[model samples]
Target: MRSEALQNWLNQFTSRSEILKNIRDLEKNNEELFEELLREGLTYEEVKSRYTDFSYYKGLKIPEGARALRAVEVYVGIMDFSDPSVMRLPGWHDGNTPSANLIDTSALFGALSKRIERPFLANKTIYSRSNCLIRYTGEALYQLDWDVLHALICFCRGQFNKRFEVRQIDILKMIGLSKAGYNYDLLKDSIVRLRKTDIYIESSSKSPAMSFSIGEVKSLPKGKRRRIDTFSLILEATILDNNVLALTLDARLKFLFGNNEYGLIDWEKRNKLKNNDIAKKIQCLISGQKTNMQRHRMEKLYQLMGLTSSFKEFTRLLKHACEVLLAAGVIKAYAIPAAPRGAGQDRIITIWTTEIPTPEELQAVGRVAAYACGE
Candidate 1:
């Protein structure tokens, strides 16, 4: 009787165990299928490598001018930063400048957030780099327009250096969004998850209103870094971006030379950069370093071994290299002038091109004229 009872219990457990096993197998299959769809056209390494770089993304596929909730939230953040109250502070620019009466976050938001009566309401304390956090209200969730958000981000970054990173949990309380005791941890969690899977979150410091290039700053005669006192940081940003993009174009265009018809083939793949001392010093100049040497001697070396020919090629490479650096956000665009002569014509030389530069290119030409003149 005891043996029969034990057999009946074992039979029941076996059936349940088989059902559990099936459930686990089904879950595994679903996961694999979902991953397959996600990686349909991407290679494993391509998909894996994207996450290595950091960026600022507004939301899922928020195309230009498309409306979305997160987009609106981001826009509001920009508006909050640009309010006259924030901008008009006497010492705001100095950061150490003090104000007799500082505006609190709630009052500032109350003043700014009115859509009709007051459209620029803000909520957190508006002091220093402490941000005016706009809580992600669920009410306007569907209508969060993204174009507005992008414009706002661009405006804020350009105007005030304000940038949005991953949302913080304490931000909800700071912005007065936790009144209902809602678990905003869930909201934070969702955004965090999106960041992990999406490739768009990476962001750069906002581009400047105008373009500039890496040539703005140059090394002086005595191994010292000279500041381009004339070029503003904002101008540098724009130049940097353009240089990078142009460089990418140049690099891709270089492949055209590979045609046997063009006679661009290299017999020795000439390593113009040898281990020679002079060569290494030249490398330093290209890499933004300074060294002391007699200009006459340097000029002599340029002619002695036909280094100028090499320099001509190097200049072409330098232009392309600058573009690459700008693309990588390493430097900005700057117009360098040609050497000057007493009682001689002071002509402008577009450093990266052979053609005469446009009027816009001439705006900052005077700054580098002396340096290029070798005076």
Candidate 2:
């Protein structure tokens, strides 16, 4: 009988503060029952069992600051918030100096490749290199999608499963897009596409297959309705309002960064090469390698770039891209060896040791190395 009454009272309140206030009121009338309920119903074990993780805390009256900390705890499993490495990362901030952009090795291998004319819902194998196979479903993604995703990741500071807010104009500026009306529309489309795109990765290594999306957008509720006659006004107001976009990255992304399986691309150089998709893709591919010198077959490069041009044209484009990279100091030198007699494939070899690191880059590398060593 008492349990039934307690559940009825609990269901009447939606927020935590309301529940606490009612509980205090109950204590005033029934001290013995209140103490018993506090011990049995609100114990630490019961609370922990009910709210096992951050996701379970949503829609509750938890403070946003506390939510952020709890999100880190749930995803990272680090109890000590005092650790500097848990809150900060190299190349994650935007400043005067160039910072590194974090990208998963699987993505850097051309998962988000050239643009497709039509969006497809069925699973399609977009990129396959060596033992890595990447399949994607949903809207077609291109260089712009890649740029938007990178900027969003920077905004989140590499924290997955945490909500962050940003203005559309700020996103545009971060991606080197001008603040025009059409650009805002383009940004909105890109965000939607990112939310819809699903990626599945398969590798020949011992690790199992992984699947995830880039991020999800949060929708704001409409304002209260005034009257039927004022419907148009309300609609117009909603359309004209400049609302901040809220986004949460997937927690599974942390798996990609684990075991030093991620790569850091020079952010400034990427922005410079933004107009040239081929050059940016090549830059990512080269940056993902462990050694300074790398070689790839021309046939494989053609497929990896998702280019529809003829082999001859692709080789021409590849040469030009290398020249652009050389001018930008992204690569030391590149050579495309001609196919020998009756050879099935030619190779494009590149060396990137000539590029000098900025002070920020060195500091970032030092921090990563220290963290890896568990310092």
Candidate 3:
């Protein structure tokens, strides 16, 4: 198949004369007879001189970082920090996507529920914390599940309607997929979680209960090859189209992205670092928060980031993240506050705006969390 890059090259020289000339000059000496080349008047030249002739080049030929893929354009944008502002999407749930698998006990949300072992809370199945009530239902989604959701959210943001078309290659690229390559089974299970896991939100107002996804999948085997003569001529092989993957976003999600309640992430940077679990989770937690200034206990934070590690171990991972976040100024500094009485007893992490935080500000609520929590 012709890469999007190569197909673009073919489009540059629309004239047959230019195509034939480029082909012969670069064809590496094996120019055999063909009705097409004969029709175009080309010869089998075994040797060529390193001669230079000035030719007026056409417009930009998709240089290496043509980072202008359609989804990329929608999800990412260049920022002008002089007047700092972020892209906001309305009705974005901004849920605390705590990791299920990170803590061994957390995944118990599904298995424990199956055994009905609880003195059930709110709605016989609800879990509550300060000011929030969650009527949990179905198997809890893990970090991997959140991965799929985040990808879809990235796709759905700025889109008007709920429906969108995707190519398999596109999803792979967006997720910053590793060379280990696509895991078809994992993808199938993720779709099921999005479809089957149901939860009802009852914070500010009442709304409909919905399940994200439920295991149903239809395979779209690769489609028939596109018939582009110029493309075929370049590779001397057939080229196939990417398979289309169609999905519907939950209407609730429309509140997140469609309405402009989205967070701006430096995708270039995030994409580069996402393979590291600590790095990936921290970036999202920092950006996903609705408020500009957030202070959370290290323990709460560990839960929020979905880390199952002990205080000592999780902080080790978190310390690594602080290096990146601090250098980028995403976080001001960690403060293990000697708060009034018993407020925020655990180590506290105070986050700052995109701008660098002042030293005095860092010192005020400030005691190093590492020392407080035992580095």
Candidate 4:
């Protein structure tokens, strides 16, 4: 039975019939606490405040430094759970597929690279560029791992703090891999690596330093029986039964992805780049930058890609990658200028015009044109 105070609080949403109905249904399952609180002579607002406090602190061990951060208040009253579309994560929801893949700039820059020869390192700094620093304490991730991570991010974009379900096959398809038995095994390995990996990201320009695993995954048993052959993926914080892979993306990811600190990778273009790992890496770096024309030192590029090849071999590969990018329309032109006598480093200059430019980019172009015309 609903308490009078609970009833009064719910009455305020009379105009939103669907939300009101959902709220009523949810309250039916959660009425005991409200009833007990009402019996204790607590007012409606007091009860609500207490409930909010309880929900915020429930199963969470917030550190002293993190306590100063503001909490994201999610109002359950406005949520329309009856519509499955409403519950879908952003970018991949409702069959409205996004043309580009969204990724945090820090990760896009070079957090994960093609260094897979060494075993997992403990408390090792994987990548550091400019003001951003990334430390990892698990299996060393590579380009494929980056793709897997990006797919997970797409799955949990809007609901970063919430647990959700995803199928293993869906993940495979998202990363442009075939759904084969070997692929399933590979996916499981990647998932385990991601789960065990503890990442510490610090970007002075974005947010305070934070540490968390990329995600958590648990493989469910087959049906009522404990068989383990076929399984789907489920994203949940808690353990559950069934032949599925349960995943929970770390909530701390919001710090990196929020405040427009993320960039969009052209999904089609990336897929087209395919097995050319160097070109793909270059695409990621170029996509994350604001300007279409950019120059990067050859040594810096080599380090950023984590290539183990000799400088001469890397330079040869880079030239080939630039040619590939030009052929794919990812870049209009690229030039590797000859190093001057006594110069320590060579530079690669690239110019491009994206198929779809942001408003800010458009304005910048407009300003450039006006300046060129002496307006």
Model 1 stretches with alpha carbons more than 4 Å out:
1-310, 338-364, 367-375
> Candidate 2: where is the Cα deviation over 4 Å?
1-121, 129-133, 207-240, 341-344, 353-375
lDDT of 1 at 45: 23
Q: Can you write out model 2's per-residue Cα lDDT over 1-375, one digit (the tens) per residue?
A: 124455565568676556555654665676544433432221122232333344434576665334332322232232222221122333335731112212322333242334446446445655554566555666666667777776777776755456777788888888778888998888887777677656654444321111222323234457743211100000100122475777876544443343233446666666676577777777766665666556566676677666666677776777777777777767765556555556534544434444444444344333210111000
Candidate 3 lDDT tens digits, 1-375? 112443354466755456445554433342221111221111111100000111122653432112112111211122111211122233343332222111221221221112232332222223333333334334454445556565655554523224566565555566656434455455555666555544443222121111121112234447953221110000111113555556655433322221111344554455555445555556655665555456766666566544344566666666676666555444554434444445433667666645444557666665554421111
lDDT of 3 at 306: 41
TM-scores for all candidates: the values are: 0.15, 0.58, 0.48, 0.57
Q: Candidate 3, after superposition: displacement of residue 115 in Å?
A: 22
User: Which candidate's lDDT is highest?
Assistant: 2
Rank list by lDDT: 2, 4, 3, 1
Q: What are the runs in model 4 whose C-alpha is more than 4 Å off?
A: 1-118, 206-243, 341-344, 355-375
Candidate scoring better on TM-score of 1 and 4: 4
How much is 47 displaced in model 1, in angstroms? 49
Query: For residues 1-375, could you state the per-residue lDDT of candidate 4 as single tens digits?
Result: 223555555456655554435544443576543233222221122322433345336678655222321111123333332221222222344222222212322333242334446466665665556666565566666656677766776665545445666777877877778878898787877777666666555454321222212323335555642212211122333323442555666544443442223345655566666667778677776765667556566677777666667777777777777777777767665556555555534544434534433455344333220111000
The lDDT of each candidate is: 0.24, 0.51, 0.40, 0.50
Pairs in clash, predicted candidate 4? 165-235, 232-245, 234-245, 234-246, 234-247, 235-247
